[model samples]
Target chain A: MPERAEWIAVDWGTSALRIWAMRGSEVLAETRGSEGMGQLAPEDYEAVLLRHAERYLAGDRVTEVLVCGMAGARTGWREAPYRAVPCTPAGEGAVKVPVRDERLKVRILPGLSQARPVDVMRGEETQIAGFLAGRPRFDGVICLPGTHTKWVQISAGEVVSFRTFMTGELFALLAGQSVLRLSVASDGHDADAFRDAVGDAISRPESLGAALFSLRAGSLLEGLDPVVARARLSGLLIGLELAGARPWWLGAEVVLIGSAAVAEPYREALAAQGLAAELVSGERMALAGLIAAREVMA
Target chain B: MPERAEWIAVDWGTSALRIWAMRGSEVLAETRGSEGMGQLAPEDYEAVLLRHAERYLAGDRVTEVLVCGMAGARTGWREAPYRAVPCTPAGEGAVKVPVRDERLKVRILPGLSQARPVDVMRGEETQIAGFLAGRPRFDGVICLPGTHTKWVQISAGEVVSFRTFMTGELFALLAGQSVLRLSVASDGHDADAFRDAVGDAISRPESLGAALFSLRAGSLLEGLDPVVARARLSGLLIGLELAGARPWWLGAEVVLIGSAAVAEPYREALAAQGLAAELVSGERMALAGLIAAREVMA
Candidate 1:
């Protein structure tokens, strides 16, 4: 192994794979590829990685390769055990596994977990750590919305706890494939209907299970405009999330990490709960997590 | 018009077209076709109805035609007003409209509605009334589980009030077409997983919105077997229904009208709620509805 390596970190997620050769906090070389874990084949995963590495690293000698996120998941290279919650970047340890050849050593970061019912997360832990990297002193709630929406709470830089909501996945199912598909308009926001539905959802949250039926009932009874039903569904789902997460997050400050389109509704939902929040780009957090993982490995 | 003609009733559901020719309470002939309103062009609707009617009648003369279900809605042949709930077999009147030549008089049954917040039912109301037919007096909750499920409170041969659930539609969307489709096993039922999920959904009814996340999370965290997730989803949705309906339905006799396979889970869900329910065939209710609708026109 070389005494020192040129590149510092690599981050892979659901949508894209990104590599950063960092010298401390500064990036020396960066390369991106279309190798999201969802699209990779198990047999050719290593080959795909090598191709991307060759494109970016050329012949540079590297001592270590650290990966965070889905690539370390069961679908990716290897399944890494999850670290239980009430964890922090400083306290959490990286799980190091040797790569295929002796020349390369890879450390697959451990994900976060909750006991009792037993819930866990993989890539998001790194993102949480990355979010903490720049704002290490910050504390309170952090929401990462996507296919599986995460509502995380942090205290003194440690991830105290978190819960997951299937907002995005449900939205996709309802809007793309369900009967409601006939009603969903374009992707643009419908603020009025969104606010109305969010309000209804939060007020009588117990009715949420029954409320879902309204999407069909509304259309059947009153010719519920499909666009409105779409917004109502979005509202009911977010409202349920707020109702579930609110008990744990009454007065905590909220930091939302995701794309603008995804994060905006959540921001509005939180605001409906009378909780104010700040928005942080998910890309930056991934980058931040890559940097943190690198530092820990160093 | 013939001096005395037999009764003809038509059921226009979302998928198929059914016609019944009845003399008093006895059904003389029954025929089905692929002429659902959903598949017909607006201009060709009359032609479709006439063709189907002729095929079913086979030259038999019909005195009065009573059409129920979606065929009467704004999107149907003619817009029929909704009947406010606390409705009775006698109160269930139809809106008279002209079809083709022969001064054809067809009565479109009105849907039932609730004041204030505004909940309503269309075809299910007729089915519920039909289910109540012949019995001297039947009271309690009757559940019509289908693409749009209806939970109706019936008393003294009247539909007092009801709530709708979109269970079947959601199941089709999730298991048949959504991303979750990748996780479902098509061979048969997974009873154990179904029961486990039913327990989870019923125990913490409010957790339904969160519970859906388990489909993706289970796969991510615990190597959630796809088939199990599918069953879990089915259980969770039914569990939510049991939870919501339990408040109004505790101690009330329950009758579920639908296919045995579809209604069995609901029966199990109700049992989980400490409630017992009888399974009634949906086909019987459809036929009963045709008889009742014929009687109304008579």
Candidate 2:
């Protein structure tokens, strides 16, 4: 007989789903899918989880699932009303869903919101919580680079204030749908081009509008390479984000929690500005976060 | 039979083709089509124009066709290399394409390019040329808002300097393709929301990233109306454009040339900033510019 399941850690977002079979602090098995909240109806969440976890499930064993991200959104499985910020980022305020199956006990964690600046985050809070669990005394800015990149402030084990930037979404749209698509390559990087664009964007941030259109003009006038074009586009967008994030990152000890692909550019950009930033593997943080949330479930 | 064409004025853009059947300075008839440069091969341009102008091409006599916009692009009918800046926006150095149809004489006019800021505009140059012809001695800024908005400066019949902003494209992408698309509406505008957003964006342009995400957050947390969401998005983008364009529009005699629908927001934005500007019909300006360019042809 297989070892009985203890609990599951799930990160259910709009477009992707990730789950780890966990026993205490150790992850036993992991699985991910495209069956995220956007692709499933409210009633289908239980079945979908079971289908992906077939290999890990044991006969007649009840499994506790700790969930985060859009699974708790109004459009997701069930609405977990946001816990307004100045609160700890953790398993607290979780919403319990009455599942049809007796074998599943699911608790979806609540996201954090700021009332004054009017900001909110779904998945990154759990990652922040996990980072905090690992480094209890650490207090500074945590940069989470994703579709909506976030800069979070932490003090006394609570999320103080945070801001979100649409840098990644802008890059994706421009690279795929905008005129720059002709000049942008799918996979390449030019360090020199990126560094120069970052410098220009920070000093003359308002030039972003004119500079965006220049990708086409430069391609037409100077035959600019696609790799350079892609790099410049990425650089300009990130540089603009940094310009907005200076207050949160300049004097603070910054740590970037994201995939190597996304976090590397931010680390380089922060370094160019004379700041040393540490990057932590986002998968580890996410699994740790979900595990931490599960330990507190009823 | 329909009246034979005296001259044809064409605005062959990326996705649309527009032509005016004219005699002297008066338009006898006007027709436009979606068969723009994007939909045609180099050899296919002559046939497409002939098909669309069949009603007016009654005689064996060659009808002069004055063309502008991407029809002069390298990928269009024939290449008309851009005219470097600090020159008059007109029939200077137009490229003549040898046509298969004996009844047509086609000349594609050149677009304007700036070397320093690295900007370019194709069809807007024709409108600016027409605006300048109507007010020959008038000297100031002419704002042409569209997919790619242009701000042109004229002094003594010469386009002294100019800049282009990708405001419209950004709006389309953000509202149609990004995460904010869930909250943005197509057919509504909140005047108060727009005015206030414009004020905030102008004062703190760097806050654009956070402000954009706030559209979704506000929708989730505060039940934001889609119309208000759209207006805020538009206001923030245009405000950013204006912030970059402060050097061109401030203290200048500004004229807006475009379709009423597209130019209305710009006019309101300028008014919100306490600027009195004149509005001109883009079609009329384009026809005038083409007529003026035809007069220069040998």
Candidate 3:
């Protein structure tokens, strides 16, 4: 009477969890919850995961569940140790998360780590692997923009090196918590202002600190628009990231893999810098990456 | 038989209210409270001040209360307004607040504002006035480091020009609230680590966003000491501020006016860059500036 999952794919990050009931690669049903790794204790994770996947599970057979993201972190359900870079994003090393629910068989793919620059990524590696799955010979940089935007360099379908920026987190904190909150709107868009701020930050990267305060100052002295202030704040932070990540994006074929809401700005910013980045769906990549890992197991 | 005051000098900033029971320039009894401008509804300011100054007040005579800082802000008790820059810090404008108690005669000093860069300072102006009052012919840069660190250029007893940085605030947010919180300790100092981070940020300002994330990464990967991480985080933010404020400090006679706890890092960082900064007591400067303001009224 109810739809059953052939298998399951889960993307559990710090603040939220999303699981898809998959018939191989095609989704049969999808659901999400706020029970992310950050809020859950080591033992509390199993109940949350099972609660989300209950409707998709049958009483008789064990459903294979493949996970990516913070669920693989040390503090997650069970630690899936990080795989050193110069390796495939999600090919091997999916640590089985021992669960009491015999109806579910769970495996969390290990995240990637770099020693030199000192960087790590949990969920994005699966997306990177998914992006590379279709293009086995893909050689370029993949930019995944989110709370922690990552710039990953791919060569011969392997992640060579990567770096992460806290631009998104910083923007959230500044806009919501810092003094800039008084000057910025919670919801608004000003494309021209964003472009101008990006250009300003790129040209004078050293003035980042002063430029931030100028938003608040501009509001006080000139009655600067809250919408414009919000847009400029976003641009300045992203621009600083772009400037920091010039080595990864400059003169390289760059693909932006993120949600439209998050990835579009990077596309626009990069375009202004004379680099046209092809934008792709982050959800699709995560699914594809999970499927790729499942196929290997099969 | 109780200790009483001839007048009161109050610095009402955002978080705290510090008042001194003074006989002209000498403090007879000093007391402080948490009733700052940020928390009160403005109309509530008189009661809080009276509460702190009660023991120091006499029923027969009106006690003159001289106040500086955010208490004079637009959202503060009563808008004292701001005097545009290229002017003396605390010479002319002082707004009289209407109070219920005849025992209180309150006057709030106006702050300094810059038109072009669009900056404003309330409490710091008094400190600057104090610094300049003692050195009338001083022509140099005064560095006031705090939550919002200010770089003020002085010439001919006037503010001339100034800029503000959110370096301290940024460090606080990143170290205490952001992802780096897990890696950085709340207390500790590593001079060498601080110096290295300053050099790293100064040498490559563009890598600031990435460099910040590296501290967290370094901890996760190499067990980076939390104390070292804390120092490095402070250094990075301050170094970025220094780089941004280069125009204000380059080849200038720099004197740092702040608490030793707040000013020492800036002094050391400047020394590392071959610029020696003479550190002075912030409390003394503020009191001096308030005294100077009171003297003007006399």
Model 3: per-residue Cα lDDT over A1-298, one tens digit each: 5499999899999999889999978889889999989898889988888787888898999998889999888888888989999998886899988889899898888999999989999999999888888988899999999988999999987899999998999998899889999999998889999999999988888888888988988888789999999999999999988989999999999999999999999999999999999999999899889988788767
Residue A121 alpha-carbon offset, candidate 1, angstroms = 1.7
The fraction of correct interface contacts reproduced by each prediction comes to 0.46, 0.61, 0.74
For residues A91-160, write the lDDT of model 1, one tens digit per residue.
Answer: 2566665456444666777778876344667788888888898888987788888878887878888888
Q: Candidate 3: which stretches are off by over 4 Å?
A: none
Which scores better on TM-score, 2 or 3?
3
lDDT of 3 by residue, B122-235 (tens): 899999999988888899999999989999999988899999998888988998899999999999899999999998888888888888889988998899999999999999
What is the full ranking by TM-score, best candidate first?
3, 2, 1
- The per-candidate TM-score of the B chain, in the order shown, comes to 0.88, 0.97, 0.98
Highest lDDT: give the candidate number: 3
Q: List the residue pairs that clash in candidate 2.
A: none
Relative to the real complex, the DockQ score for model 2 comes to 0.75
CA lDDT of each prediction against the hidden true structure:
0.72, 0.87, 0.91
Per-residue lDDT tens digits for candidate 2, residues A210-248, read: 888999788878888999999999999998889888899
Clashes of 1: 1
Worst 10 residues of 1 chain A by lDDT: A1-10
Colliding residue pairs in candidate 3: none
